[model samples]
Target: MKEKKWLRTVLSFASECRMKMILSVICAMISVAGGIVPYIGVYQVIILFLDGKPMTNGIVFRASILFWAFICLAGYITKLVFYAISTMLAHFSAYSILENMRNRMADRLMKAPLGTVLDQPVGKLKSVIVDRVETIELPLAHLIPEGISNLLLPIGVFAYLMFIDWRMALAAVVTVPVSAVMMAFGMRTFNKKYAEYMESSNYVNSVIVEYVEGIEVIKAFNQSTTSYEKFQKAIASFKDYTLHWFRSTWKLMNFNGAVLPSTLLGTMPMGMVLYINGSLSVAELTMCLILSLGIVAPLTSFTVFVNDVKAIEYAVKDADDFLNLKELENQSEQITLHRFDIEFDNVSFSYDADKADSPNYKENSALCDVNLKLSQGTFAALVGPSGSGKSTVARLIARFWDVGRGKIKIGGVNIKKLPLAQLADMVSFVTQDNFLFNCSLMENIRLGNPKASDEEVIKAAKAACCDEFIRNLDNGYNTTAGEAGGKLSGGEKQRIAIARAILKNAPIVILDEATAFTDPENEDKLQKSIASLTKGKTLLVIAHRLSTIKNADRIIVMEKGRIAKTGTHKELLKGCSLYKDMWEAHIGAKQWAAGSEKGAVKQYA
Candidate 1:
């Protein structure tokens, strides 16, 4: 049953190319049958014609020549038809399966635990989703059906040989066991090497991706030499590993190549003995030669296919392992929320190692003694330096990761109890580094609320201060953002992300440094937009710029993953030393910049 289930995973994609599948199979059968006719029929005709003396002349001679020519012609036609159909089906099946798999992988990313997805390198995940999944296509579309077809040919050859003479049949069957043992030994060595080669390939891919993506930073920091050295070292290591693997498998491949022909040496000499002993006729001897010779090509092809299958073992295992990860449970339950009052009650949380690579942390202590409450329709800001766990707070509110210690409640219910889809609908997040899909500007904005109308999109874009800039572009909203909106300026991308958040219009909003990289000119407009947008929503903003959230109803100052201070921004500015220091620095910088500008103008005059 398990094996059947496994087969279904590979071939469930058959629905995509059912017509071609049926046609390919039919053509293959015709081609194999035609192959047998030429192998046996031509030899029989020659022997019969030569043996006749008085009867074989004129019409008989011409008829025999025509018959052989027709058989050869039919063989080539069937073979061509079979090959064309099989290749077409393979291409169609592979492309369709890859498209579906890529979408499935993307959906998996959305549903996977935040820690799980984030822990993986961008390159590693790219390899799995794009590269590894692609590798399965060849094995699926060609290897599977071809492997089954090859087995059938071997079976047919054995049966035909036996029917002609039981002794020859037994002789052919006896050779199979020896061949099987040699094939098995070869396969074992090849499998080990194949696995090692695949692993090294993934590592090499990761290094190449990282190096290329970081080229700009490396040059800016004068680390290009070091980065190149690291990249070269990784590539060299992979090359060495591949060479070692090839050395191990070379012997196996050579042995398999030689094994089938070696069986012929035994069969041909033995057939001569049978003929001399009056146990075999000339016809029988000729048939054995034809059939046994046909065996070598298919045997070699089958061995090559087997090796290809073994080579993909790692890719299959990697795909299966990724699929086997425990996704968030109860993701489909029905949930309804009228009010959004987020409550974190003694809610200590830690990155689960099963899902992430975390520091050596004591159990249940990412955030200790953490108690906070955000009332419905209020704006709250979390303020801290980097790694003070501010972003983690926003993540927990978003339910990206379940709280480890205490309950996180939304509308008086545990967040874990809420359906993931429902939770997603109820909350909207604008992350620090806003990710925009490589699509039309309109489509990227509509991603937040697919049901939203074009008018609604324009309205949201205006409220997020993005409409004016979008209109300035030649194609306006139709322009493609390119990968991660790399084509757009940083401020433009940030505003577009804000437009998405506006379109979502969820009861709860989490903004982690949404305006961190914007210029002052746009920042003012964005601040006004955010204030107007969150008037009736429960807002939790991870504040990178203190000036952006001075009007927040409450501010929680975090230190070392704990809430060091909590109050209104004004109160904290007066009472909290850390808050006071942060505010002073910000204010002093603004004043000093103004003074410097005045100084520079006076000196120029």
Candidate 2:
């Protein structure tokens, strides 16, 4: 039953290209039968013409030779043609199965919660998606039709050898039991060894990806050598483990290969013994030898994939586990949100390690008995120190992850009742680290409202105060964003992210350090754009700089994982000690930055 698990996974995908696979199997069978016809025809020709008691003239023998030659030629051609067709069909079905399986996995990952997707390393997920999935092509493309047909054909041939002479039949298969034992030893621990190999490969892949992605930081800190050393060491470790894995199985695999295809060793000698004992005639012994030789070829091909089943099985199970990952609860049907007020009711939350996607997050309690509400059209600002639960509050309202305990509702309805798409359509989240696909600036902005026209995209860009710089570029709005919007500077990326939010025009917006990257010169313009856009919508700002949110309708001060106070900024400054201290710190940082700028100007002069 354990051995059948991987095969079941492969066959489960067979429904995708069942008809093609069936045809491939049929062609494979015909190919096998075509192979045997020539050997049988030779046996017949020798039996009829060279029987010890008979003699035929040269004219008749010449005619017989020509007939047999033509028959053998025809049988050989059929084998080649059918085998070609069978392989072509197998490849088509195999690729189709692979494509369908990949798409399904991708869809599953997308539907899975952000935290669930983040729980696994990028390298392991990619290893499963790209490398592990590719391994299935071995069984699907080469092994299924060919393996099954070859296996079945040998059984039928062996049965015929049994009918010919039972003792010769026993001799012919003596190698099979020995081969089976070798196969058992080879496969006994294959699943565990293969898993270790994959883990090392995944670790190497993750290190490579991390090294490349963090190259900017690595150089900035002058840790290039250290980073490169780490990457090389990971790669070296993976190589050593792979070589060790192969070395461990080297002997058993060789034994199986060498012994499995030597049926003639037993049959040839046994047939000679039988002939001497007079229990078998020349015709009977000749047929047994011919059949034994024929049987070994297909058996040899079949052994190549016997142990490989272990690896493919493990791959299929891993993929199945990923596809079954937990997802955030969401309704299937869309429900209208009559109001846009954001409400968190006694929400206590923690980032569970088992379900966390972000490396920076932990099992630490993020929010403790938090209760807050932002009315429709209210401008709310959250002020807190690092890890004070400001961002977690905003994220829960946006349903990044469901609160561990308590209800987060938007418009008087629990967020879990809202369909994922409908909820997504209603919220626009802009953060310090915003993502932009590799496409034109126009398209990137249009992503917020995919149906927005060219004119609308430009209007949003102008509103975000990025229009002037965009027009100064060679392609204006048509220029590509590059990978993750890498072509743009930090300030430029922020403006584009703001432009996207403006284009979306969602009723509720959460801005977590949205102005962190903008230059002082453009900060005012960016604020004006945000102020204009938030005129009648609920706005939540998670700000580090207290001055930016001083004019907000409501300011909520956070300490640890709970709210310290809530009031207008002026009231909080007057009444709250922590808020006042934070304000003083913010002022000093600004003055320090101004003094540094002035010192630089004096030095230049």
Please give the distance, in angstroms, between residue 134's alpha carbon in candidate 2 and its true position after superposition: 2.3
Model 2 Cα lDDT, one tens digit per residue, 192-220: 88778767876898899999989999999
Clashing pairs in 1: none
What is the per-residue lDDT of model 1 for residues 149-256, given as tens digits with 9 covering 90 to 100? 676676777778877776776665455667778777766656456667767787788789989999999999999999999999999999888787768767766766
**C-alpha lDDT score of every prediction, in listed order:** 0.74, 0.81
Could you say which candidate leads in lDDT?
A: 2
* Every model's TM-score: 0.87, 0.87
- Report the Cα lDDT for residue 62, model 1: 69
**Weakest 10 consecutive residues, lDDT, candidate 1?**
596-605
As a TM-score, model 2 comes out at 0.87
